[model samples]
Target: MKPSLASNRRTDRYQSKTACITGIVAAIEDQASRPNAAERNRSAGPIV
Candidate 1:
């Protein structure tokens, strides 16, 4: 079945919103982990 214009618009909007959210989440995750990774490496006391 062929989709209507309204349906196509809705699909486009959903995709755009999802992409925006995913980008925000990725940014937050990277920022949050940055400190933890540095601390772990410093405290590991030289990997054998």
Candidate 2:
């Protein structure tokens, strides 16, 4: 048995998208705890 080309392409795209989203989320979390994070917190409301 062999994997189809379309399925492989879809999997590659899904992995790439997941990686990009993970990177973005990590970057946001890292920045959200710094000094400027205060302003962000203020704008976002009580959730901070």
Candidate 3:
């Protein structure tokens, strides 16, 4: 009736991977929504 450690690990990995992918997708969408700002920053280079 108990789950194995391997199964638990697989579930954890899947969850983390899903979160990471979601974050990346959100970042892409944010960048897409502000392409002009992103492009300007890239062209300006590091402000420091």
Candidate 4:
């Protein structure tokens, strides 16, 4: 069988949207923990 012309582009868009949402949530959490962000970052490993 051959690959379909309709690829995963549509699903990719949805996945990007979800990523945006998570980014927003992380932003909010960062704000909420603004004071400890530096300390947390120091203790935490580098993000992938």
- Clashing residue pairs, backbone N/CA/C < 3 A, model 3: none
Name the TM-score of candidate 1: 0.56
Error of 1 at 20 (Å): 0.2
Among all windows of 10 consecutive residues in model 1, the one with the lowest summed lDDT is 1-10
Instruction: Report lDDT per candidate.
Output: 0.75, 0.76, 0.80, 0.76
lDDT of 1 at 22: 95
What TM-score does each of the candidates earn? 0.56, 0.55, 0.61, 0.53
Candidate 3's C-alpha runs over 4 A off are 1-7, 37-48
RMSD of each: 9.4, 7.6, 6.6, 6.6
The lDDT leader among the candidates is 3
Worst 10 residues of 2 by lDDT: 1-10
Estimate candidate 3's alpha-carbon lDDT, on a 0 to 1 scale: 0.80
Error of 1 at 45 (Å): 35
Best by TM-score: 3
- What does the lDDT read for residue 23 in candidate 1? 93
| Span of ten consecutive residues with least summed lDDT in model 3 | 1-10
Superposed Cα deviation of residue 40, candidate 3 (Å): 6.4
Q: Candidate 4, residues 12-32: lDDT per residue as tens digits?
A: 677778889999899788868
lDDT of 4 at 31: 65
Worst 10 residues of 4 by lDDT: 1-10
For model 4 the local lDDT of residue 19 reads 86
After superposition, the stretches of candidate 4 with alpha carbons farther than 4 Å from their true spots are 1-7, 35-48
